[model samples]
Target: MEVPVMFTLQQFVDAPPSEVVRAFTEPEPFAAWFVAEGFRTPADRVRIDVRPGGQIAAVFVGDAEVPFTLHFGALDLPHHVELRFDDPAEEITVNLTELPDGRTQLDYRSVGLTDEQQAPIKPGVATMLTHLAAYFS
Candidate 1:
């Protein structure tokens, strides 16, 4: 049996689509904003290989150093990015659109989760996107 769980979240950032893409693709900006409140590390601690088959290795240091890898399935700069994580096997898609006011609208979707899983992940993604917006402000 499989649990059908998915979530879609939209957020508007006060920056261009290009800048939003850079935040997700580039290592330094990614490290800065892709963290939770108490789980941030220095930019140098993150490694991102921005390509279709590339990988992102992030180190989250709290009580201990926890490392994880996300593999990119597709990458279309300033437009879309699709990635998958191994441990629990989750797939995520990010789509960006430029609005007239020079801001970017982000559409984030994640699939392959249980109801128990979606509860926490949904809010976490929202918070991360909020941080992303703060990075540009």
Candidate 2:
């Protein structure tokens, strides 16, 4: 059996889970930090429906404009969320834990990727999270 290329990343944001979750569910905050350097997720092009079976759509504009839609698998507000990429086989799960110090611990995991797939995605995710942390700062 072929193993899926997967990765998990954790970060502590200096904000509560409610604020962290807002960054994920809100288009403006999402667009602000969801992209790597040289790429942009335009807030105007983002459409979000935050609920089970709902979807978020956005266009990542760089040298090319790539449109993608993520289908919501599960949404536990301010706590957990699962989103499936355009291909249902690929999914990302995000969990937020409330820290005692008024911060939030975020756990992010991506599964069902091939080696070729990880090349861009892994780095992109890292950059996205970095930008997210900076957004909260």
Candidate 3:
């Protein structure tokens, strides 16, 4: 079997790593920042179980309501998280690093993507990260 290409993106947030982690792990902050222009999930609809083998599920309200689930592979508080999803059969790793100036550097990498799959999701991922940055601002 051929290995799929990996897509990676990095962003710097003007907040501490702990705060950044909360944005990713906590329901309210996750819903706040995980939305794009066309996709929005209310905080009440976001359910997160932050542990290895746990899951995060949300119902996105856009032109249509859609449900999404992410299975956790690993969870290291304030530093690292690994998630897997079935629709694309992808593995995503999120790494957080703290800068000396007190900002958090977010490194996001997703593996098991084909060119066709990556093309469309790339822009959405970028948009979500931009929203995340704005949430901190």
Clash list (residue pairs), candidate 3: none
> lDDT of all the models against the reference?
0.85, 0.88, 0.88
* 22-113 per-residue lDDT for model 2 (tens digits): 88799999998888667799999999999999988999999999888888898889999999986636889999999999999999999998
Residues 38-92 of candidate 3 have per-residue lDDT tens digits of: 7888999999999899999998899999999999998888999999989988899
Q: After superposition, how far is residue 41 of candidate 2 from its true place, in Å?
A: 1.0
Off by over 4 Å in 1: none
Error of 1 at 77 (Å): 0.9
TM-score of each: 0.94, 0.92, 0.94
Candidate 3 Cα outliers beyond 4 Å, as residue runs: 1-3
Estimate the lDDT of model 3.
0.88
Task: Write model 1 residue lDDT over 16-127, tens digit each, in one string.
Answer: 9888998777888898678865687567878888888899898887877888889998878889999998877789999999999999999999988888777877898899
In candidate 1, position 36 carries an lDDT of 63
